[model samples]
Target: MSLERTAVRQRAEAVLRRLAGDQARLREDQWRAIEALVIDRRRVLCVQRTGWGKSAVYFVATALLRERDAAAQRDAAAQRDAAGPAGPTVIVSPLLALMRNQVDAAARAGIRARTINSANLDEWDEITAEIHAGTVDVLLISPERLNNPDFRDGVLPKLAATTGLLVVDEAHCVSDWGHDFRPDYRRLRTFLGKLPERTPVLATTATANARVTQDVAEQLGTEPAAPAAPRPDVLVLRGSLDRESLRLGVLDLPSPAHRLGWLADHLDRLPGSGIIYTLTVAAATETAEFLRSRGWAVAAYTGQAEDADRRAAEQDLLDNKIKALVATSALGMGFDKPDLGFVVHLGAPPSPIAYYQQVGRAGRAVEHAEVLLLPGAEDAAIWRYFASLAFPPEEQVRAVLAVLRTDRPLSTQALEPLVDLRRARLELMLKVLDVDGAVRRVRGGWLATGEPWLYDGARLRRVAAARATEQQAMIEYAATAGCRMRYLRECLDDAEAVDCGRCDRCAEALFTPEVSPTALTVAQTFLGRPGVQIAPKKLWPTGLESVGVPLKGRIAPTEQALPGRAVGRLSDLGWGGRLRGLVGEGTPDGEVPDEVAAAVIEVLKAWAHGDDRWPSRPAGVVAVDSRSHPMLVGSLAERIATVGRLPLLGRVSSAGSAGADGPRGNSAQRVRTLHGTLTVPESLAGALAGLAGPVLLVDDLVDSGWTMTMAARELRRAGAQAVLPLALALAA
Candidate 1:
């Protein structure tokens, strides 16, 4: 090797030792990546499995580049070309947990590291100052940070101009083809184009398949412009995506209750502290609570969790203070615990790639770590619900663009009534539009850039098709009668995949696959327990007036529905499946099922006896005129009244209602659709007036609670003392 090459290798080795340990040395691939970045200054994409030391490549390269840049700054000739030391390494990580782990990892090597994320809005200025002053070595920020109004318009330009190294961690997200695609990560294309030429960039991910790999590489290589120029020399390093330590297995339980019982029975038998992943936040919380009730040291982690709470849970797992954290995909990326000995999935993730990424969190540093999938019967239903949140249809997208005014900005709330998307979906669409230059986010809200934007219906359809294909692949992965590890690896297009003898199919089923009778009974009882409270909506959705409803701000206390009750959430582990079948879309209206009637009676009994019971027993029962499930609603109401022996006064008549049979849209639009639809007839009015107490208003389901609110308001107007909603299920 040349003297210069020898010196670079020595410096890289020193950094690796400090970052890892005294015996740490750069692997050949690591050395090659470091050399390309520090010496050649080339953009590179590394597709390696988790625990492959991807982070080490960037940190070592950062150390070498910063050192070289510092030396160049001191030289008279170099000083004339550049103003100051280049800048801190900017790592665009996807999760706050990943950012925290990166920041801590940097400090171990004596590198000054800091982070800017949603959780630390108060520290951005200080961190930005440190970056500008050349006092920070590594700077970590989430992908979402790239689109922050202030950061995008202000700090980013300067940071882009001087960044020493750009690292896109979990880089698969940049590709629309990836399992966990985020529109915010698409903003990286613009950020990449803004970076000065010859700035070394590295994209790292553990989950990209060949298609995702190609897409991300193309994005990394090409500069975004009117006429894009592709840099064909982008380095792509692909390795075998295999985790030898992970002993994969799938244990199929008969039902949701059986699955929970299996977990309660077998959780202690897992190798060590780890994560129990669920498909939804509700499932995670329920699973955690159930396990805790069974005397297990566990906690729930989800995107809905507070930042401090997530951090605390992360730390607790890292310190081995808890057996495992019951989590959703929120706990998926960038949580570092080398010795996490097991991963248990309560329900199958919709994509095999995503499942691989999540399970990769386990068996990283241990020689033997257990990985199991307890595929639920409701897995497909849960997957379908999440799939519905994908990009809006062309007409909806057009509606969003149509309402934006070039003369002034409109906040999302201002735009809600004009369009039909939910708040979260609306915000996501806006971000995509912003990145496409159709709309721009300003300080006040969002402004139309007046740029010509075509709706890409074909591409959207293709993406949706791809998602369906992936969902099918995941379903196959669960049922495949082959080596589970090999199946996952092959799903990611890993050519080296082979039947692993360690897998259940290849060897013998490692688990007993049986739930203890006691555990099964307890799980059934836990799941069968019903009654999720429905907190009344205190405020009318903003922009109601724009939607033709003459109300805004808080709903009048007198008119608002009282706190209500449901047999269970549509997403509940125990009752969710049955409820979805009964009340979910496409079911023909019919009399209440015997089991459902029993569940409703149980809910009423508990509601009347619980500490938060109504002020007084309802004097009568009143069914909301549900156009979609009228029979179900009427029968349920009759059942409740009969069981309690309360007077079945009458139904809240939908006689004068003037909208579609089933209202659909956002909160404001739904309210607008239901506003004047319902009224009490003269007979029901007289009966309500005669009664002295509140009535139990019944419906098939409570989603958005606007229907209940509107129905209750009418009941109140008709002389019912108060209206309390009782539904068969609460939509999640």
Candidate 2:
């Protein structure tokens, strides 16, 4: 293709103006990216800061590409065979919020944009048709969509053959070394390989350091036929990682209560509406509730939230109707707000890259936005919890491969019992395996590809080591006594790591570290109040029969346990630290601590007297014998029976290791393990037979709830009217 420089420049300016208003103009870097795509037909990796107009490069390129294609269609004499209108620019976006914003932004440039994501499954066929008809100029899809069986097998080949441009938003996720690496994004390798040879590809991210940038660029430059081939020429445009509008700081707080109090005391003083990031969903919910009680309008946003609620919460934040959205990382990638006022972290994110990506959400369009981190002792624990979910061991992966039949597929649920991984982890592993050629996902489920797959233990270890280093970097970032912005920029390998003189350290402290007594008291009380209900399992896990457990379908109401109560979740902001100390992974078993006993008593008192109290008072207390923490469970049951003036019924007996404490793989395997392990002893049966009211079945913790379920069933058969399960903690 031949083009006049002045004409291309003029066309790009027009598109940019259309996309970003009349006063908008493209930066030289953005223009360079556009030229690379539209004129040079090159693959570009753009590592730019947030709000740096990376999207403008793509939007302008799309407009220019499509317009040139249209001009070619009009001028048949220009070529012997005229190519029809170009295929829609296919964008594999990472987030729904991002896709929505992109669609809206594309429309402003008079580009017909459509998205096919989980939120709009019904419109996928229509969108596909539009793409085929060349009516849609831009099509955005989640990365996961690239691997969808139907889409991959039916529509992807044609789309790849004709796509004019391929844009990968948040391309950092494509690198395992990146802070937020996702396995699904790895599927882009296949998609990139299948793309038309001349198709221009653009990968953009704001959080990538030099390492991640190179990795993503290499992935983009790889030839379809030979991934091992040397990296081809790729246009890499990496700008300064500095966000001029952000003023960063860190405040050392004594506890979660003090941090929440500080937020309640000073949220309004920061800036306009922004976000409060929490480490866990439970913390987000609790923090939002506490803020609401203090008269600040806030809503909790998490991945577990319903689609409608998340949309409403997002809109509330975007419209500035709410003071802030209390959220987890679920709100990270695609959210865009120009004038966000502040971003406060209840706890530090595990890595500086992740921290920068999130805090980048603020101070985009504004002159100044507050970015504060309140580091907690529990942050490391939360990080460890997440780190535990990394790729499974070699043995586990081999077991999964062994179970797969080359001729048939097995659904994840069907495979859960056969493997020792949870549903989410299993699915993620399968996706990674599929990318490695060990397995393939088809219509029914996943099938072994009959290809030799080497376990990349060395690479996995390298990634894990990188994660640990990032975590250490985060710790140093929190404690650093120097320029905060410069520190962050350096972490991203940005050459422009000069002191901003705007942060609390570089300048005078802009925020007071003090928490008002009234706010502190309120936070303490709110967090102190505890009692999380444990809803009983209604139906047995599917494929239980295959696991050698006959149980299937719904649990008969007569044999089912009533909804129970836990003092609090191990992830709870208030009691989590204490509970974790008592029962977390390597903690030694001991008798109940006085504080925990008191907390359990308080939970019982609340359950007995509060609104929606148990239907009836328990007639007796029965302990679920714990092999891991027998003293704790026994003491707790004895104390509760004594305090409530009820009989201490005999404990449920465990026949073998199946009844041992801790997680037992997926639900089916857990159920199978506990199916016959829990039995009502003769003494417990006699006591249950004499009970006139519900019996409180106490345990140290409730994870899968299968042990409790089987124990309850045994008690019900022994003639207890109802079994009310209680636990010291509920695992998240």
Q: Kindly list the per-residue Cα lDDT of model 2 for residues 1-732, writing each as its tens digit.
A: 345877899989998888898999889999889988887778899999999988888999999999988887677775444332278899998889899999999999989999888888899889889888889999998888888899889988898888889999999999999998888899888887876556788999999998999899889976853445444579999899878788888999999999999999998798999999999999999999999999999999999999789999999999989999999999998799998999999999999999999998998889999999999999999999899888999999999999996577899988887888889789889989988888999998999988989999999999999999999999999889999899999999998789988998889988878999999999999999879999998998888887678888999999999999998889999989989988887789888988888988899888989887999999999998888888889999999999999999889899877556576588888887788788888988887786789999999888888888888998998899999999988987
Q: Which structure among the candidates has the greatest TM-score? A: 2
In terms of lDDT, model 2 sits at: 0.89
- Pairs that collide, model 2: none
lDDT of 1 by residue, 1-732 (tens): 789889999999999999999999888888888988888778899999999999999999988888877887788697676423378899999888888888888888888889888888899899888888989898898877887889988889889888888999999999888998888998888888877777788999999999999999989886633244446368988889889898999988888889889988988889889999998888998899999999999999999989999989999999999999999999988899999999999999989999999999998889989999999888888888888777788888887887886588888988877788888888888988998999998877898888999888898888889999999998898889888899999989999999888988888877978999999999999999988998898888787776677888888888889999988878889889888888898888899989889888888888888989889988999888777787888888888888899888777767444312332567877777777778887888999988978999988888878888888888888888899888888888
Q: Which residue segments of model 1 deviate by more than 4 Å?
A: 78-85, 224-232, 655-663
Assess the local accuracy of residue 574 in candidate 2 as a C-alpha lDDT between 0 and 100. Answer: 96
User: Model 1, 321: alpha-carbon shift in Å?
Assistant: 1.6
lDDT of 2 at 87: 87
Which structure among the candidates has the greatest lDDT?
Answer: 2
